[model samples]
Target: MSTAKPSQFGVAGLGVMGVNLALNIADHGFSVAGWEFSPKRLAAVQAEKPYERLKTTGSLEEFVGMLERPRRILLMVTAGDPVDQMMDRLAPLLSPGDVLIDGGNSWFQDTQRREKAYREKGLRFIGMGVSGGEEGARHGPSLMPGGPAEAYEHIRPVVEAIAAKTDQGACVTHVGPGGAGHFVKMVHNGIEYADMQLLAETYDVLRRGLGLSPDALVNTLAEWNEGISGSFLLETTLQVLRKKDPETGKPLVDLVLDKAGQKGTGKWTVQVSLDLGVPVPSIASALDARNLSAMKDERVAASAKLPAPQAALTDEEKQHLAAWTHDALYAARVVTYAQGMRLIQAASKEYQWNVSLAELARIWRGGCIIRAKLLTPLREAFTQQPDLPNLVVSEAFAPVLTRMAPAWRRVVGTATRLGIPVPVFSSSLAYLDSYRSAELPQNLTQAQRDAFGAHTYQRRDRPEAGFVHSDWS
Candidate 1:
């Protein structure tokens, strides 16, 4: 008789994320079996002996065999082709009712298709969005899982056990069915891009306009973090600013290249938003900023020919710049999140996901990269009105925005006068302004389209008439 015991959970693709997750599962007293195609990775994990309850194998078959029946597996591989290849290989080995989770930043449509295909094969496919980086994985991460309800039930215990916990509860949820999890995660990344860009812009303005040193900047941000502006990214920024290069003994961030890198999620968010007819200009602008940053050489060359505005801040502007920027940062951040949430809402309605924005807010309160203090009231706003048309108009935020609009405008105006680029700030403010306005210049746009192309327009007086064309000859 064999004296072997089957693992409760299985993980394929033992990369950094996979190994840490496996270890996390083991730490929670679940026997975990990990499969790695790379012998080097397998050997390294085995040598580490991080957990006695965890086992690693290079053989996929052995890895599957060692897992308990109706096996629960997590595929932490690169998104796209790798996920499909692994699914194909695992299909023959998995029994009916087995569950497989794709724990990557995958395209939501891909997840939807994979779920359908797996269901046809009598297996359950879950598109799970695991947020927080390596450290979060080893400790805890916010988990967003969307799949068959029963399938979620199967792995819920393991996930909930390993997920980041807040005062409310675990940072995990059954987001919805199909690709809802990935969709939400995509928007989360989009919001992350905007928030990061907002921070970068703030840093640039404060550093250049105010002549604040790194230490001074840290102090300002630290004070902000103690209030509603507190966030994982802000804290990380402070840490980065505090870091000194060992070799040069200078602020490490200053020595680093100005170029930014991305992994396509931000672009996907913008693309999907357009498809769903949801405007996310803040996120769009952030994506554009990254694209523009990539052309550093071009920018350097253009700087010589293109002259910047030579305006300087007045005494009044000097005294209130930081205060105004603080308001702009908070207000713009709210708008950025509003855009992301609205995008999610549109997708939810389009796909019938029934995702609770409140639950998402709760889960995002900790662990995730975009975790912020604002999520609390944001959650409450959704709870109070599940069908909130826009977060800017939410009861909790409307007054705050009204109060802060003056300062936000001041920040934008000051930045503009100094020739500082604040794309997200300006775009987000425009989004807010457009949302608040009952009448817009789009009436002229309609007339122009109708005059040139005979594209019909709807009249305010007779909306029942529908599609009326005007002749301007």
Candidate 2:
């Protein structure tokens, strides 16, 4: 077991994502040491499974001791408080040049704090955003690593080598300093929320309007995956839909619950967008859907208690509704990604993240849940112009929106008329239209910001950096 300076990789947490990433590292030929608090959890690693390269250490001290000098460890633990626990325990034990990588759904502010804390200990802290979910963790993850360039140098080879690769190459890249990676990841998740919302709306239309079974929907999704709409998440959604229900004769997806659950990342995405003065309406609406789903009991009661139209729907109207919904979902989904990328581009300028949007799109294409083949053109567009303001105006994507907008509009009109809550998709289209319009009703908003903060604002007449202060009292 003791080879002269064998490259050792250790994962500190044994949670689902952690376990899968550890397995991936081991599966890819790197020697791995995994540390978990519970012996019972460690027993699962010992169990006869496909990946055997992982060796569980008895204690935290022991795990830290196993790695060679300039040790590299990835903390795949839950984000927030628990991250500090690992740092506190290991900072003393780790050498000056050792690296501690955080690969979790942590806030960018937290990443900055942790990186600063670890730097004082002389142990480099890498704030990395590791995406691709469970399967990607076990196969190829799209990794965004940010920290000291030296620390990145030590770990980049391992990370890039193990990351998910396209036919062209690896999905991993150095995102930038401190919180940049996590910030980028946060935006990525926000975009994902909007994308999934669109897909769900499309599914609703297909099911309600076309009278398509889950199997039929799966077929449609699969076909879409082959075209410009193609993506890893889309491909998987088809798989999830095609699965048969265990208790019933229908598709498993049909039998499954409708409500979607969310972790904090999506919320963070919306919050960050707000803080940055960036509009992510589609993402916000998607988050709202999950929030509404969580309020099912209240919503159900409201439906029951409120005076509502308890009427039957006509078949023709239903078909029209579905057809309209599909188009709306597509347009909204595209706009959501556009907004998310724009937010990141704005941040890149502010924070000096030096992020490569092309690599980001490519990395997202495979490992992440929102991945799709449409990302290839996105990646290419970004590569050509690293600081492109928005994915909406990208030459490759513009034509798509131009062609689809009319259809998308028709769908939105039909859904609204039918009283369907196509929030994610509809909200996206709304925001898109508003964004393109030269005029926006911002007088009220500016009045409010000025009223409270007395924040300086430029006069519309002069349009200069000079402020026009208002005395509200």
Candidate 3:
């Protein structure tokens, strides 16, 4: 019952990402109808000649008229509530077979709800995860689409052509049904937060603790970027520190706004981890760091921030702090990335989506928001063992961590003695220890679950259980 035609698509919202994506689609020879609420924005887009054959429509009806039934509309609007607003405005004007694609960092739950509602109208909806940032939007991105299998077919060619590719081919694929695409994107953001916090903490230790200059810190970071810890986030942090303010000749980062703004996916990642019964302390710490960053001004004014007393650092102490922080950062990064991949795996399993974890990793190897060369090994690791707990736990990663563990411990102990906050790093080390723990009290959890929900329990001695518990005195 679909009515989509080839070479017809529409990009709604003329934000930077949307405009670039529109240009990308148009460059692929697809006729696109670009819609924007602002006349100025509409004119600006027109002025850019993003697409030579592009059409501009002020009316929703005219935009719909540009395509056949099952129209393809990509919503490049803001995440959360704005997505719902756009859908409400667009739904009534579309026909039964139309398709709505959300290219924002929307909550996966919202995507699921929207898809259900759209289904009732005999329309289709897709929750798509697109990374590679603004630059990638103009050239290529890592695209993850989740929804009807049939709907994917109509858009696959364009998605493939516009996604970052590996040695094999294009990087895009149908992620899975429901909200898997958005869910995966949330994990990506969470991992991003962890990665950023690790590098920041490293900078703090080197600067305040070791009295290294910004240039030194940048040098150290660049070195890390060359190894397993090497990734897009670390590389970018180095670049940011390299930026100097022309006005005062100070680092632009020092004067740039203190309150770091986020689009909420990182918070959602930690929240979802809690709900899913996953231990994501590293990710949680990263989330807490973001929250704390927002309160920087308030914290500074509170009794001059009541800075903690400094401790004398012995050679051993300095060495330990450096080592421990390294391990923690390295381990935490692995956990956060693994947690994201696991989330994607769970979503794919739960929704019957055939998303290729390997392919997703490959897409991340280049032009997308989270792109980094490290993804090559990650993609390869997954290909070898799809059920890996994390990249850190893999045989390939063991030697790397083993070499890095001593440094990680030193850094952690030094931070502990100095009362320096390193939540993400500490949480990552904690996660590593917990994962490698030989025994956990699962029996107690089972007992609690049975007590609350009358859930069945399995006894150690017997396959079928007479539920029992021993009270610890």
Candidate 4:
């Protein structure tokens, strides 16, 4: 109730992400006024004193009052119903030209629908995808914002200031109109799932097949992080491996349950891929691997009935296989990212969002879960050829595939021989082979379809001619 007007930006919701992001804004010299529906969470925020500059209010009305005219408000609540509920409450209180930004993991379709609804009422709605977890929120994160172009100016400073920066620039962009931000974020999470699965498979092979202890595994992964396979996820895996259990005096990872949990972004990615007619075999396989892992009881029972794995590698052979496994992991990751980028490209065309593939790679190069050295080359590849068909065939990556093909094959073969389940690894290799093949066995499939369902088949001799239906005797 000072005579002064309020801050430049307001944040609604006081969850961990919400508070940290508010603090991040405050850290950059922007006064942040925040509102939380949960009194317990608001009290905790007050107790923690996360940032000195954040102003808090007890009600949404007062929070709305605590911002400047044409206010920029960031909504960090849970996605779905809660978001709609909050908007319904807040929209009535705001004047025209006031901007509300959703920084949640909302479905892109919801964003598209909401943007239109809000626009008709003279309110600007931005569906922004904020990546990087708690740590990134406190420091910096990659931000993808899509909305009406005019509304972006009001929030651009806050977005850029709180975003991670590399030598290239800040890890944030006005992606495109209508739900483009969320769509790209969804694809980002999909690639993350596949990348993590590949990492888990690599760890399993090195530990089980090569007899590497957790200590040895940590060193190996740490070493790999210094090479072409280096990444934030790989670096984090090394840290996880190094942690010891307090209760049992063993590695903490071994003590934890093997089941992985996801919040559905990966599933959405594969589903959307099907809708768009894009092949995302690596991503699909990764999602299936997680589902397969979740069937722990059935897997445990089946393990007893199945044949045991055989590990027959000598120390010399283990050394060679470890190197090959590294290359194999690199190859899989390349394919996974390539498939994800392709999905984004297809969506851009279908949605008319015109998102820049090069900018996406540049922003993802920092403050994201999937940040890696690989993105450097990826950014360059897209920059050189804006419409490059696939990343695997890019000049920067094709040589890598050529050089690693033999080793990648050996890793898959070694895993197969040892009975290690490598769904993603094998699937990625299969995708690569299928992509490069000029001829496939689908002709027989067409012939069979024609016989059973009268589906027409195109002859190779007259490929451009219309489809011809033939009766099978």
Using lDDT as the measure, which candidate wins?
1
lDDT tens digits, residue span 1-473, model 4: 47966888999997989999999999999999999999988998888855657988779998999899899999999999999999999999999999999999999999999999999999999999999999988899999999898988789999999999999999999899999999999999999999999999999999988889999998888888999999999988988999998888899998889899999999999999999999998889989998988999999999999977766776656769889999999988999999999999999999999999999999998899999999999999999998999999999999999899889898888888889888899999999999999998998999999999998999889888879999897
| Leading candidate by TM-score | 1
Q: Which 10-residue window in model 4 sums to the lowest lDDT?
A: 308-317
Per-model TM-score, in order, reads 0.99, 0.90, 0.88, 0.98
By descending lDDT, how would the candidates be arranged?
1, 4, 2, 3
What's the true lDDT of residue 356 in model 3? Answer: 75
Q: In lDDT terms, how accurate is model 1?
A: 0.95
User: Residue 351 in candidate 4 has what lDDT?
Assistant: 96
What TM-score should be assigned to candidate 1? Answer: 0.99
Worst 10 residues of 3 by lDDT: 464-473
> Residues 223-300, candidate 2, lDDT per residue (tens digit)?
667766776667778888878866776777766666789888889988888888988888899899888888877888
* Pairs of residues at least 3 apart in sequence or in different chains that clash in candidate 1: none
Candidate 1 regions with alpha-carbon error over 4 angstroms: none
Residues 1-473, candidate 3: write the lDDT tens digits.
54534338888998899989988888877778878888888888777744556777677766777774568899998887888888999888988888899999888888999999999988899999888888789888888788888888877877887777677578787777888788877887787877778888887777767777888778777776786666777778888999999988998887876576777888888788777777677777877887888997787897376777678678865555544555556665666677678767766666676667887787667665566655777788889988765677777666766777667767777777776777877777767666767877887888788777777577777866576544433
Give stretches of model 4 more than 4 Å off: 50-52, 309-311, 314-316
Please list the C-alpha lDDT of all candidates, in the order they appear.
Answer: 0.95, 0.79, 0.77, 0.92
Q: Local error of candidate 3 at 436, Å?
A: 0.5
Whole-model lDDT for model 2 versus the true structure? 0.79
